[model samples]
Target: MRCFIFVVFLSSVAAWSEPFRPWLIAAYGDTTNQTDRYQMGNDNTVIDIYTNLMWESGFLNVSTINLANKNCVSLFKNGYSDWRVPTVHEIQSLLDYVNAPGINEDYFTSLPSNESVLVTSSSSLQPTDLVLVVQQQTRSISSQYPPDMNVRCVRGPQRTAPLDRYTKFQYADKNFVKDQATGIGWMTESSAIWFCDQAVDLSQVWTPTIKALFSLFNQSNSPLIDEAVFSLPSMLYLGSSTPVAGENGYLWAIDGSTGLFQTVPLLGPAMAYCATVQLD
Candidate 1:
């Protein structure tokens, strides 16, 4: 009886584990046209071939919020003038969980150990005036006034040459995936978890694009499309397996949770995913 019970328990656990699989099955490829995958320019800027973004090699110590805003645009690096502070997601992508400094050390050699807080352009949920900040050492994030924070400027892919003509995807971080083909990066974690067919609540947080789309028609529908920085994955992007109860824990798709093509809820507790175009 004990052996039989153990076998049943093992079977139940196996049945319930909802494993995640990426939609694109092809192994990520290399940059076709770039001379090197990573290139350091004349100034303290480095280019990322995978995501096609240019990053400042180190953090800039700005004591005040006004300075942080003005710092990036004021300087010309490598003859490129269009530099802006990175978004919260963009800065977060630099963190490497397996390594110290949480970023790729090879490309970014000038990072300072004392500068812990990096300011982002994203506003926080609480008290909308505050900006988001990322803690480098702890890999934690908080939203606060940016009176004293470091600023790192970044620019989109360069126009000098073709970075890559074909589509490829690379893991920016555990939570984010970068697609070179579409030049879009996706967030893996869902905002909320729910069963299929649950109605989305309208009062929760959502990007303006998501809010507008959901206002029209949201259902277990077909032919879904993605827009802007934050939205759920489409059912088409979700794998072909139908979500099984007690298995395949629900994630908000482009529709309400449906077995087939669906859109994500505009506002709901359903697990939400985010996507953004690569700066380049």
Candidate 2:
């Protein structure tokens, strides 16, 4: 009996030690110069790990979106000639705000210190000649009419798990939904009454609502559910990177604005999307 129990314990330990998900791996096709993260490939190309996308590190002064698209196709890199603009989501994933260049510095080595704006694959929200401009370092997604933003070319299929942004589930007789890609759990029926245009202070904006909601969730006397505290999700988590509008649309974000990020249609269109890290 003891021997049987010991073998079971070992198996459980091994299972627990296994990796939960695959992390970014740097390789020759995705890296160069024998360096990690990303390295400059031959020519002006750089291989990034996360999206498996080849990027042109060159910054250009293009006149319009049409010209930018043409510029990418005209250039050849590393014996290949397939290049195009990166999507808003792709650009968002590349941004590492903690890092110096706000991207992989090894690959994109010489980015300017001053604000560098880049054009995305998306068109204007209001359907003008304007296009979305992604600020290189910070989380700013503004629009520029006449399309004056710089262009960065990317070529590769986007990799993401085949799951809904929010997968609804039931636990302890209460409703919960988890963001499949990010593993953030949210209470389905709970939300706050926050308007987008309302100017809010940094410390107090999302705090009181979060604490109140968490307290409410904890009040449910269910033995199966514990640690029900919830917090607000970052703009990135709530589909801020997505360029197009859909049924599962925008949520109030802590990023993307100078002071109190505002959404369109005042408060009517804006929705609350509170999320919390799921504990095992």
Candidate 3:
């Protein structure tokens, strides 16, 4: 009886020691290069051909499974089906250990896009995916000031006219210059606001609120203002990078004149704000 018990214990230990495997694997046609274009999906939802191929032909299936939809989850209602929306935690886990050397580069290489790279943290007990979702929710809240607070105390009047005349950077004709100091592309204010991608972090591109943009103009050649910047909606940012093929992306702009922001769908004219740090 003692020996039988010992054998069972050993089996349990072995099972526990085994590493977990992801449902998907890298199949043929998956490429890490960002320049090559290829077709994905069977046919119906045929989106544009991507430069890199993240072919999903392995143990796991890669379908657009919307976790928010009960019907979508119902489609995979079975044991060991091995398909679901990647929890924010799972996505983060993929990001954390993925960049390490000697890891399975093929798996990371086969992902749909570079933006899908995950960043996991050990401090949180919750799954990385859940953590990400919570963080995003909090960020969204912070972006827009709370409605319950008294508007007069927090709100201020918008400044009209260009705060100051400053040189703006133009990306149109491939006129690019590498600034030795901050490494950011230098440009002047076109309107009151000067919209551009954040050089420090590309994942989060920012646009200055009209108030903040005006402040920069006020500073002019003296120095830029020092404050946290806000971003336009994600749809606008994505549309700026990729041309809006079919439908225009929607965004909400705060208009201080009316004290009410308006939601509008747009294909272009989204902007970002920045500051200048003098290095001498």
Off by over 4 Å in 2: 1-36, 109-111, 123-130, 158-166, 171-174, 177-280
lDDT by residue (tens digit), candidate 1, 77-109 = 887776765554345445542346645667775
Ranking of all candidate structures by their TM-score, best first? 2, 1, 3
Model 2 C-alpha lDDT per residue in residues 150-181, reported as the tens digit of each score = 66666654324433445667644546666454
Which ranges in model 1 have alpha carbons more than 4 Å from their true place? 1-37, 109-114, 123-130, 145-147, 157-280
TM-score against truth, every candidate: 0.44, 0.50, 0.21
The TM-score of predicted model 1 comes to 0.44
State the local distance difference test value for candidate 2: 0.40
**Model 3: which ten-residue window has the lowest total lDDT?**
3-12
Number of the top TM-score candidate: 2
Against the true structure, candidate 3 reaches a TM-score of 0.21
**lDDT tens digits, residue span 31-143, model 3:** 22223222334311111132111222221222212212222122222121222232221222222111233113333222222112211111111211111111110111011
